[model samples]
Target: MTDALDRIRSIALLLPEVEERVSHGQPTFFVAGKQFAQFRDDHHGDGRVAVCVRTSGMDEQAMLLDAAPDTYSRPAYLGPSGWVAVNVAADDVDWALVEDRVARSWELAAPARLLEAGGR
Candidate 1:
């Protein structure tokens, strides 16, 4: 993987049965029919790629907001219920974290059926 798309694609590779597609005007990767992560470029003109992680509503907002206000933002309009957006700015973000989140997203979205089927 080269950029955010590549990074996300890499993470998707860890799961058994998952698919990638464009949805809601962005590149979205899904597992077992549920969306785990979505990739977004800062703007059509810019080259920065942003990755959004869907967290449990239980996620602590105050700290997340304080730590990296710029890289971390609301998960789109849905930032309210528990989704946090983390910048995967290709050049700066720690890819390992992104990879980990992607892995978790797959686990979160992948249904039990797919998990049991198990295959590359």
Candidate 2:
């Protein structure tokens, strides 16, 4: 569990101008002061450890949730805003998928200049 969290942190921080901070008692990744992703550990006693990130839009969110119920879900509070949660604690954790989600979230929150720089 700790390993997974560490891996998430590493991937999120590697994004351009990303910073990690504690918000609502959870580790949140921000780009240009806007939140993109958050690490939730048993959030609100739900007993699920996952990374919640912003999606391209509601359609993307619905597609992911329908495609992988076990791996993805609509996070509370943020779901209506097109945010999706990826279950990091699943038995078959897909780090590549996680990285992609983080990257997309970063791109969504990043400034135009950062995105124009290729977001490397």
Candidate 3:
């Protein structure tokens, strides 16, 4: 929906230096021209978005899996590393969480200059 897209775009704007485009038939938010997060729509209960992010205090990937396994899963190959996939459509998506992860992903992918401009 346009509303969801708008929300995502708005979040992307928060990342000082990032690009937003359509990739893999979905809205993708990139950092340094690399994909960090994407939105997908599925008719089934399958995942409707892939949110890749970084963690510090604890393993972000594991955080999602342990906190919300039904809605989040380990990324295909990066699962062992620390990348988690969240199902935005699985439940009432917490936009705040989405915003946080997208911001974190952007932080990870964004360059230092860009991060500085984005106010970290």
Better candidate number, 1 or 2, judged by lDDT? 2
lDDT of 3: 0.66
**C-alpha root-mean-square deviation, candidate 2:** 0.8
Q: Poorest 10 consecutive residues of model 2 by lDDT?
A: 111-120
Q: Write the per-residue lDDT of candidate 1 for residues 2-120, one digit (tens) a residue.
A: 45678677777566767788888887777777887777776454454677766655456456767778767776564676666767763677877777766766766777776667633
Q: What is residue 30's positional error in candidate 2, in angstroms?
A: 0.3
TM-scores, all candidates, are 0.75, 0.96, 0.70
Q: Local error of candidate 2 at 116, Å? A: 0.8
lDDT of 3 at 59: 63
Give per-residue CA lDDT, model 2, range 1-120, as digits (tens): 788789999999888888899998989999999999999988888888999999999999999999999999888788999999999997889899999989989998899999898886
Error of 2 at 47 (Å): 1.2
TM-score of 2: 0.96
List, in order, the clash count of every candidate structure.
Answer: 0, 0, 0
Q: Write the per-residue lDDT of candidate 3 for residues 24-101, one digit (tens) a residue.
A: 556777777867776655423454555544444246566668888866776554456576666565448788887887
In terms of lDDT, the poorest run of 10 residues in model 3 is 41-50
Q: How many clashing pairs does model 3 include?
A: 0
Instruction: Give candidate 2 regions above 4 Å deviation.
Output: none
